[model samples]
Target: MGNVFDNPSFFSKYMELRSDYNYNDYLEHPAMESLLPPLKGRSVLDLGCGYGAYAMSFMRKGSSSYLGIDSSSHMIEKARTENAGAGISYRVLDLKSLDTLSTVFDVAYSSLVFHYIEDFDALLRNIYAILSDDGVLLFSQMHPLLTASYGYSGYFEGDYFAFSSYQEEGRREGRWFKEKVVSYHRRLSSIMNSLSDSGFIVDRVLEPIPREEDIREFSQLERDLVRPTFLCIRAIKKKSK
Candidate 1:
């Protein structure tokens, strides 16, 4: 997944898409922000932090330190130049290597990156080990329904949504920016269960709905009313017994 973003053409297209107001800006971010705990004087770890886009924002919110990690060197380089600030640092590290980290954090946040990880259980366990007791873990991913389909068309047919293969979970290959992308699909129950098994206490689950103002601003967002495009979870690391 990280290699796909390293491709100049795909990375350029992705940057262009993010430059505009899209689902991430209007839907995902708002919900994630709402679930965030206090950040003042707390340490933050951002997983799959592309270009360190949210690094400064977290710093501005009074976080004592912020570490943004991504697997793409291109993204880390751009982040160093574009989003760098005091108390903010970027690392070129894959999510799979999280166990290599020894520093504990008060908050761990990820945005739309988990589905690309093949080993969800290991990922959560590593996160648990790196978080202080009762540390907050807030993350979002493509909703199960959206990722369940093998070849998903991001369009609806009249009133019907082409949804299938929900019970089957595994690798799903699709195209993004004319580049082949691979993502793993897991049922919603699996996600919750993995978190529990990793010693996290579920706090909040969100399937964001576009506010009326958002729909008025981007009419295409009305499609989300039919089916959620993203799912957000806020959980806390369970205290050691």
Candidate 2:
């Protein structure tokens, strides 16, 4: 999964896509921003923080410190060059090695990265261990409905969309930017249960609806009205009893 983004062609195509107005800007970012807790005086650990895109926003919102970690050295290099600032730093670290992190943070944030991880339970447990009591974990990922179907085809069969294989949770390999990318599919119930098992209290879940203006501007986003493309979650660490 990490190497996919590091591939020169994939990385270039991805950066170009993100640079323009797109779904992340129209739907996902708005939903994520709505779920964010106050960052004033807090420290943040960003898992799979590609290119540190949101690092400066955290600082501008009054976060005392921000650390963005990504598996791609190419991403970390761009982050350091573009998003570098006081109290902001970037590291080349895979999400699977999260247990190695010793510093507790007030907030753990990830965007569109959790689905790539196979062991959801272990990821939640690692995040739980590194968060301060009452710390927040906020993340977004591809909606299960979007990833449930194998081969990533037959999504729109004529007027209706095909959704299946939701009960089976495991690897789902598909093409993105003309390259094969792998991601995991877990039901909404599984996601909630894992968070509970890891001592997190689910606070909010969002399946964002594209704004009317956005839809009017980017006509392609109208498809999202039929089925959501992303899901956002906010959970807090449970205080020890």
**Could you list the CA RMSD of all candidates, in the order they appear?**
1.9, 2.0
- For model 1, residues 1-241, the per-residue Cα lDDT tens digits are 3478899998998899899988899999999999999999999999999999899999999999999999999999999999998999989999999999999999999999999999999999899999998899999999998788886533222333778899999998877777787888999999999999899999999999999999999987897988898999999999972
Residue pairs whose backbone atoms clash in candidate 1 = none
Q: How accurate is candidate 1 locally (lDDT)?
A: 0.90
Off by over 4 Å in 2: 153-160
lDDT of 2 by residue, 1-241 (tens): 3479899998998999889988899999999999999999999999999999999999999999999999999999999999999999988998899988889999999999999899999999899989999999999998988878777732322333767899999999877777788889999889989999889999999999988988999987898989898999999999962
Candidate 1 has what TM-score? 0.96
| True lDDT of residue 61, candidate 2 | 100
